[model samples]
Target: MVVLATKCYVEGDARSRALDGMGSMLDDDLGELSVEWTVGVRDDDFVSVTVEGEDATVARNLLRERWGEIPTDGRLTAGETYTGTLESWDDEGFVLDAGTRVRVPTSELGLGPGSPSQIRDRFGLVQHLPLRFVAGDADEPARLADAERDRLYEWSRGAGRVNVNSATRGEVRATVNRAGHAGDIVTVERLGLLEQSIVCAEGTDPPGLLASIGGYLPAELKCVIP
Candidate 1:
């Protein structure tokens, strides 16, 4: 059994679809391997897969390659690098979920000059967006990876869309309808079970669209503008 670094927080029919999708993804990742697996969600939205079959070992390795491995032991060792989903943030730092909770201090965020929330918006970092971080020495805080920084830099320069979390794809679409901004989005990209990226239509401003629907969904929403 490997606890996946990703999450699945959607509910109802959306949740059913997400699980079925996850199963298909795992099957594709394993290719021709003869494997039987079950997808399960643990507390706080942790997704795990238990595989059994002739090619289980190879299948497990493939899973690790696609989605960073979850530490079954539940601890991030000093100096090790790992990927996790952003859970929440405070004045001090952001907390990530990787089987166990890991904290990424503001100083370790690598984003500059703002409150944690401000920094998140500046970079369009949405909850459940996978990010890599390295654990620090005894006195230092865990720091964000250069790769994560690069990804954020790219998002900042390339488009106009809001990245959001804690809402299923279906829920996002419904909210957009209620907000009367159905035409503003070109598409919705699923980042995780409950995290999604709204690709804005060519002339639509992502921030403006976010403002239109932000109040309806109680979740973190950040924008990417071209």
Candidate 2:
């Protein structure tokens, strides 16, 4: 069993739809392999997959590479990198929901000049968005991973973006088309199963794109203005 880093926090019919979507994704990813698999949401809301068959090992590795894995042992080894979903933030730091909650201090964020909330807003970070971090132990402290920092910094240098949560990539793309702003976006990048980033085309305003499509999503939307 491998616990995935993405969350399936929605309930009711929405939850069923999300799981159905997940199943389809699993089929696309593992069908070629001689494996049987089942997907479930754990108590913590993180998605978990159980696989077995001739090619189970290969399929498991592919899943881990595609969606970062949560350590089943529930332990973080010092200096190792891990992925977690952004849960909440405070004046002091940001709390990431891995298999467990990992608190990353503001001083350790490495993102320039802002409170944790400010940083989250400026970068258009949405709840449940997957982020990578380096684990810390007694002698040292945990911090955002260098690769994660580089990725967020690159977002600022791009042609702006509208980040969203609680919607699938397909849903977001459809919403853009429905809003008549399909030409405004470069692509809808999947940040997780339910989180997506709409990269704006040149001269397309990210905030304007957000306003046009936000009403259709029933999801949280924020912009990264370049």
lDDT of 1: 0.82
Scored against the true structure, residue 67 in model 2 reaches a CA lDDT of 95
Q: How many residue pairs clash in each candidate?
A: 2, 0
- Cα deviation at 105, candidate 1, in Å, is 1.6
**Candidate with maximal TM-score:** 2
CA lDDT of each prediction against the hidden true structure: 0.82, 0.92
Write the residue-wise lDDT of candidate 1 on 151-172 in tens digits.
7777666657798887767778
Cα error, residue 199 of model 2, in Å, equals 0.9
Pairs in clash, predicted candidate 2: none
**Model 1 spans with C-alpha error above 4 angstroms:** 167-187, 211-220
RMSD of each: 3.0, 0.9
